[model samples]
Target: MRTPLFLLLAASAALAQTPRPGVNYDEAKVGSDPLPDLKLTTAEEWTQKRRPEILKLFEDNVYGKTPAGIGAPKFEVTATKTDALGGLATRKFIHISLPDRPAWPGMDVMLYTPNNVKAAPCFVGLSFGGNHAVSTEPDVPLSTRWMRESKEKNIVEHHATEATRGTESSRWPLEMILKRGFAVATAYYGDIEPDHADGWKEGLRAAVSKEGANTVWKDGEWGAIGAWAWGLSRIADYLQTDPQVDGRHLAVIGHSRLGKTSLWAGAQDERFGIVISNDSGEGGAALMRRDFGETTAIITKAFPHWFTPTYKSFAGNAAACPVDAHMLIALAAPRPIYIASAGEDHWADQKGEFLSGKFASPVYALFGKKGVGVEEQPAIDTPVGDFVGYHNRTGKHDVTDYDWTQYLNFAARHWAK
Candidate 1:
């Protein structure tokens, strides 16, 4: 039977009217290009041939290639407290800078190691708030850099105040983590560059660019996410030199946007044995093709500075994108990776995050490692999977004790041996 021309036109109009700004909950309405295959049979083939190709696709199409000419970071230990955090741990503040780039404002790194441990496994992450915001201690110096304005978070006039200290302490359970025999190293993400569009002018990106502040970013040039990932790597370099840290067991973790940063950092640098993402949507663990809560069109428009300018092309036409979130997860193959979501974080596409890990399972199998084994998404608060652990916790988008508990357990399962 042939369909009438008018009826066909009506159907096309309805399709065009599908809300681009609205959330999509129906599976039938979702569309995705088939994931790029993990076709190689042996680890050697994957490492030598296929792996590099996938990596290049991401470098060129998504996060952009990390620039190579930046000078090595110089570290200065400005303060050391042997009896910090109520004598539960030793804390140190290290000022990191590039000697060649005097114009750039470098970062301050805060590290805490357990009191009795000879060598403790470390967690490396970037905080949206500064080091002072992460700890309740009064001695921790307040960050003087520009911060995203948030009256509730206690930032006034683009600067963090005394009231901002320990505001994000709940997100970072330092006392619990230290008692569990782990060290923590963190730096403020803004220290690399502020989150706004024009932030690059004052950051390392401009300092290293040949054209300086006036330089226009090319399509595949590194973006804010890449710059932040580079900062994380520099912190890792310093950890390797610390005798109190178990450098071999270092884990990279982040929540929300920083979660996206950690994934990119872990993919590029293999020094992190465990990788964790919490509520990282859109450009993070959620599949970009899924027309779910947050879409490619939305993220690219709102946070264009976070990715390669070429990424903007995939908005509303995600099927044409060469890579998907699953490929990003695959890049961390054989390593213990954990993707976490919250019950109320629909904007992050919780199910989509789980599916990325599921799709990446084949790569893990190639290395004789397990992945998210369940065929379907588990109920909220019920943790699942093996090497690729996942848990849709029972709350909103923020990180909680439940999420941290899973990460600690997952890290122990893989690293405690």
Candidate 2:
């Protein structure tokens, strides 16, 4: 028996309008019990006492535990061009190799420092494609790593080709970054671990695990996001050694999944003085308990390798999770952090991101720093905050010139002092 077309259409419409339980869109619906009180009077006391507990909760349930004391890698400068980016910048391509692991693959680091500064504060993040894809510089090396092919982007056969160069130039804005008197450093995320579930076999995850050990990650064990965050820390290790880099002022920034990585990296590694998240959404800056767009069920099912096994248990039960996104933000207390959102990127939950910043304000206050100043979400493109910053720009899910403008301004305001 076929249902009437009118009835079916009406049913579809109703279904679309109906909101799912635990998945809230209305700001009024957002309510959670107060975060655990550490009972510390000073911010320094909170950092000494509560911070470790919060970090442990995230590691035990969310991004999983990364091993401590991962030794430094050997850095080799493969190519250096003093006259690059039309002589306004100097480009350096470096090879990073783990000790006694020749068979394990090494990663490449690309840097662009402004010629005018002896030591410049820099923005460091992982890039999606090869280094050559970030800029059109002829000297930048093409990546031989396993790449996801996109016919639209001109990548062919799961490999990067000449056509793939500078395909992601808009996201990078290298010349603009250099002109702002800040150096830029990036490495391919795949160099540390590929995005797929099986990619652990080919990357550092497997190499670092004990020989003959089960490579399969257990509950609370490190996942791909953990591995990528670990990789960024390694880059920081290298930057500290470079005379041309103002290591103390480095900002780690990323978009989408990499944005999540940036937050996690900033939380675990205090070497990053500033952290920025561009539409990081649920696992990045959005409050998970809001049960807003891009619910835990959707994320974990799509990217099983991104978080720990324990994380999956809280899929439909967000309240059951011990730590929410606000706690993650609090982990970076007292440090300058920025969270940006796109008006059209609902899957990333713009309002939820703002609320996370708001909830995190108390932790910042404990440290004698202000978080995002406004109680409500600010107007589009109107960035707000003191030590913590946030803005929801009018756009879809991607980085833009407007975003960079705000970032540069934020960095100058906080780090210039």
Pick the lDDT winner.
Answer: 1
- Candidate 2 lDDT over residue span 1-417, tens digit each: 855333442332233235445556776765464544434467767878788988999999999999765556899989899989889988998888888555458789998999999999999999988798998986688888877656656767667899889988899998899898999999999888876667778888778877513566789988889999988888888899888899988899999889999999999999999999998987889888776777788778767788988899988887778888888888888899999998877768899899889888888888778899889999988999988899999977889999999999999999878
**Each candidate's TM vs. the true structure?**
0.94, 0.91
lDDT of 1 at 182: 93
lDDT of 1: 0.88
Error of 2 at 86 (Å): 0.3
For model 1, what is the error of residue 202's alpha carbon versus the real structure, in angstroms, after optimal superposition?
A: 0.8
**What TM-score does candidate 1 get on C-alpha atoms?**
0.94
- After superposition, which runs of candidate 1 have C-alpha atoms over 4 Å from their true positions? 1-21
Residue 189 error for model 1, in Å?
0.1
- Model 2: weakest 10-residue lDDT segment is 8-17
